[model samples]
Structures are given as structure tokens and as C-alpha cells.
Target: NTAPRPWGRNSRNEVVVPFCYLDEETRKSVRDDIILAHNHWLRSLGGTASKDSGHGIKFWEAVNKKGDPEYCTLGPGKSWNDNVAINTVVIRHLANTNKLSAPIGMAHEHQRPDRDDYVRYICKELKDFDAAFERAKRADSRMTEDALCNKPGQAKLYGFRGEDYLMGVTASALALYWPVNKVNAYDYDSIMHYPTLSGDAKEECLTNEQRCHLVRWKDPGNPNDRSVAMVKENLTPSKADIDWVKATYPW
Candidate 1:
């Protein structure tokens, strides 16, 4: 497409690439690319879009306005500044045609691997971004579950199954996220949500932001990628939750 893709570094060869893929990682990446592109596009439209929510084609005048997802208007040009502008126009057409889908909770799936969807685990920790997205994809069936492929960025499937199972997975992967976060977070909240304060209980337990702090990140420099950063907030241990973690998974 010769456009500047997200997470991409264009070379002098004029061969632009996407931060994510479009063939196998196509499904989820469609949304991802749109999200990445729109981060720049939305501002051009005279409105501020959430780095998380705005990363989709829903706002395009086509589907929202005209209807099309495979247009160059949505991608950027060689210049890094051109990506959002190009992708913004492109998504409008995609949105109109019903080709684009939602981004969040997305499953980056493709009918086939564009290059190497089965790359090695990007994080190789207990849980990986490719894995989480893959889990969402497998849970949906549109995505693939080839963990051994060695493509490095492809996703794998993950499910909590139950509180215990999630705790188990979290425990297993804790080695991945723990050493870095500093605190030996033995407590992992799965089932019991943050206690919602109604009456005088408003000041009770931790807020959502506090909870999100527990989730691991691929980027040590930018742990919080506003565009796709999962909400770890209000997802940690409460009094009961803490007790449950201690009793259930004391490790």
C-alpha cells in the first residue's frame, strides 16, 4: 500500500508495513490498524478521539458515512505524519462497506499467515499480547491457535476458565510480570470484581487504575499504550479477593 503503517518503520525502498499484520492477523489487525490510523485521523476531523476507542472505523462517514474498509484514504503516506490522514479517509470507505470491525476485545485472525503469524511469543512470559488476542480469536473461532509456529508476533489463546484456573495461569506467568513490577503480587483478582461503593462504602477498596497496575506489559518503557492498554484498574485484590488469593493461590 506504500502507506506508513502503525508500529512500522518505513525504509527508503518505499515499502511501508503495518504495525500489525492484515493476512492472518487480518481480523483483529483490521481493527488495530484502524485504531492506530484514527489516532491521527480523528484529530484531523475536528474531534478528539480516545486512544483506546477511536482506533476503529465506526466513525468513518461511509459505514458511518460512505461505507468501505479497503481504501488508501485510511492509511498514511511515506511521511509518518501522513499515516493517520490516509487511514482516516480509508476507514470511512471501509466503514461504509461493512468490511471493518470493532477493535477492542478484538481477535487478530487471518485466513492465512501474511508473513509469519506464528512467530515466537513476543513476551514469552506467562501471557503474551499475541496470546491474549489469540485466545479471544480462538474463543471466537475466527482466529488460529498455532503457538509453536515461531512467527514471533502471532497470538495464542488464553481463558481464565474459572477463578482457580485463571489464578493458576496468573501464578504461572507471575514470573513474567512479577520481578519487574517489584511487589510480589501473590493476589490476582479474577472472579470477584472491584467492590463497587454505593453508600458510605465509596472509599473502600482500590480503584480501577490501582488494579490495572498488576497486569504485565510488553513495553518496559511504555507499559501503558493508551490505544490498546488493557484496563488493569479495579481488577486487583479486594479484602475478600486478597483472602481468596491467599487461600486459593498462596504461591
Candidate 2:
């Protein structure tokens, strides 16, 4: 599914991305959010410099002769014409759960092989970090600090919610799908990154007492220890995000 599709570019060298909603209802529900998200990207690419500017490439929405945004239908034997299809079912689920900003579908453009490795690395690291924490708790039942804080290969493990483990996995999988270096380090503020409190649409942890039960501390033995939210939800692209896009799709 991560395979690259050859989309056409306009005379201006802007990538023309054709897209459609699964149905009318889905269109009505997410049309605004979709447009907002796309416009954010467009502005960033256009270098408008109004809180969302950085990329050096451009993107154009596929339009008909009337100049209206085209919404094509996807079906069996139907030619997508290099169009990117958005599934309504998934969109509705995200909308209902208040995680509309979380990236999904074709937005992740990394090679499948690399994606698999990244996912495995993140999952294993988290699991090992949790396991080490448990071991330390079993030995000392009253520690007030994270035992794995300074441990090699385990420094990134912070106190994250037990229920949000999947979010961590997803965040890792959807992270900037490109080679990262100190100059282009991991962007914790990228629009693709999910906030710590994301996916909790029902506000399961509304109170201190409720939050206590929902969050998992690295040092379970410490009553004062607290869980940290991994990342904050970013509705717009960051400078690093634009840099990555420009690098990937240079003109």
C-alpha cells in the first residue's frame, strides 16, 4: 500500500493530487477538515510565511473545466487516473473519536521495507523499556524515580499511558518516513505526530483520581511519579515537515 503512484505535475511543476470522498455523507462530514488540512500543506509549500511556511514545492488540487474541485468516484475497474482515494469509514471513526488531525491512509509515503523496520524498532524499544521498569519495581517497591531514565538504549522511554501504547506504535510508524539526522532530527511537532491526550475522545481521565488509573508510570513504585504525554497534536506542518517534503519532491 505504500507503493509510489505516479501522479502528474502541472506546468508550474506543482504536484497535482486527485482525491475523492467515499460518499456524499463522508464528504459532508469531513470536507472542511480535509480542505483545511490540504490548504495548510499548500500554504506551506507556497511559502506564504504565515505560521505555515517552509517547503519549496507546490501542490494543486485536481479541478474540472468549470474550475471546481473534482471529486471522482472509485470503484472496480474504474480508472483512478492516479487519484488518491480517501475512505469515509476511517474518517468517520477518527471524527467520532476526536482524533481528526491524526494522519492516516496514503499520507505515509515511506518505503514499506523501511516502515516495517521502524515499526519493529519502536515496538521493541517500548516493550523493553516497560519490561525493565517492571523488573525494577519488583525489586524495590518504593522507588521515587524512573530507574530507566539514564539506562543506555532505554533513555527515550518516558512514562506513557498503558492504553495509548497503540498510539505510540502508530506515531512511530507515521513519523517522518525519511532519513533523519541532527540537522533534520525527529519532529515532535509535526502535524503527523499525535498528542498524548489524543484518542481519548470520551475523556476517560477527567479527574486526578481517574487519570491515575488510566496512566502508567515508569516507576510504578513511586506514588509521586507521573506519566508524560508523548507528543502534542500539530494541525499544521512544521518547518522540518516542509523541509522533508521539499527534499522528497524537489523540482
Candidate 3:
């Protein structure tokens, strides 16, 4: 789901996020990293610490469900309703399970990646756009189409599905779920952004040429040729990311 959780306030007026682990042992592996990462955003809002009195967000260990040792009940109390209780955050090890397929370091809001489904979505958006553009190009004069693709402003519309449509979909989802305002430019440095090399083992391409085949754009002068831009992994949230959270849940 792309909707934001209806988080409840704690005694300190901080938004309480009730976290649970499918494998309780996993908690030990990720606790420090999670706290440190969250602290970055908390500190940006002028909070002294992540869970201190001045902080706007607090992480609480969810109470375990009755008779179920593996899974813990979501929300603050016995009821599943978040509005009446606390917001829930569940974490699972994606590597250990065959039930869901996701990239090693990838974090999706909901739904795991299915190979066929992923290809279909990418083709539906990117290939459909290309097909439509090709039809439009055929209807117009060859020189007209060439000139349009060669223009700096129009070139972005011609051959960059990965940079444009794919990234646009992700950005739209983030804006819909998060408290961030819509932005014209995509933030490549956002921690939520996927790296250029991100994919399953089967999806990994050995060379840049092979990788560019998946998503590439034409340059202003090189209308017929295509180029790929590498997106490095963002280890932490960007300044814009921190600002969005601070604005949404101010201390």
C-alpha cells in the first residue's frame, strides 16, 4: 500500500512507530543501523536524539500476538486498528524466504518483485511509450522527428524511459505515501532511489552496453545513439529527504 500510516502520538507527543520482526533474531542485526538511520532525520529536525523528549518519532517493539510466537500483532493494543492504536512497522528477511522475491538491498513499500510481473510492467510503460512515439514519428516527416529528438528540451521525452517513466512512477508513489511535496526534478540521491545496478542475479548484465539495452536515452546531438547514466547507491537520506520529514512531523 502507498498510503501513509495513521501514526499515533506517544506520551512525549512523538509519533509512535511499533516495529516488529518476523525473525526476532534479525532485530539484533538491524537495530543499530535502523536507529542510526532514523537519528539522521531526527537530528535534522533539531532533535537532540532519536527517541529523546524533543524527537518527533519513536520506535516501539510491538507486543507479541497470543499463541503465535513467530509473528507479532500490529498496532499498540490488542485490536488491529491503527487509528485506535499505534502504527506498525514489520521487517522480514527477504533472503531466507522463497515466498517473496526482492533484490538483496531493495526496499519496497508492499508486494515483492516477480520476474514476469516486473518485465510486464516495465514493457507496459516504457515499450508502450516507445511504440506510440514511433507511430507519431512515422506519421510525421523523418526530418521533423529527428529535429525533435535532437532538441535538448525534447530529447528527454524521446529515449529515456528509465530516467523518465520508471523513475517517475517511483517518485509518484513516494509523494503519494510520504509527506513530501511533489517535485519537478527527481532526487537521484534519495535513499529510496534504486541504484543502476539494482536487480536480481538473473537480471544483472555483465557490461554497460548490455545494461544500457534495458534503459537508455538519446543525447541532444546524438539523436540516433543512446547513453546511460549510472546511479550510485545512496547510503543515507538526502537533505531534501530530511527536510520533508522535518516539515511533516516537526518537533
Candidate of highest TM-score: 3
Give the candidates in order of TM-score, highest first: 3, 2, 1
Least accurate 10 contiguous residues by lDDT in model 2: 108-117
**How far off is residue 213 in model 1, in Å?**
14
> lDDT for every model?
0.27, 0.40, 0.40
Report the lDDT tens digits of candidate 2 across residue range 1-251.
55323344567555444445443466677777766666677666675322234322333344557765444444333544334344211233123212322322223211122222222112223323456567556655753233343222232334432213332122332222222123343445566443434443224334332232223223333433343323345667777666666655555
lDDT of 3 by residue, 1-251 (tens): 75444355677676665555544466556556556655664444466424433436555555536533333333234434343233244554332211111111122211112211221123222323455457547655462433442232332445434322232222221323122323423445555544445442113334543332232222322323234444455565666555545554555
Candidate with more favorable, higher lDDT: 1 or 2: 2
Error of 1 at 28 (Å): 20
Runs in model 3 with CA error above 4 Å?
1-6, 28-36, 39-55, 63-87, 94-181, 201-206, 209-225
The reply for model 2, stretches above 4 Å from the true place, is 5-8, 48-184, 200-230
Which pairs clash inside model 2? none
- Displacement of the residue 46 alpha carbon in candidate 1, Å: 9.1
| C-alpha lDDT of candidate 1 relative to the true structure | 0.27
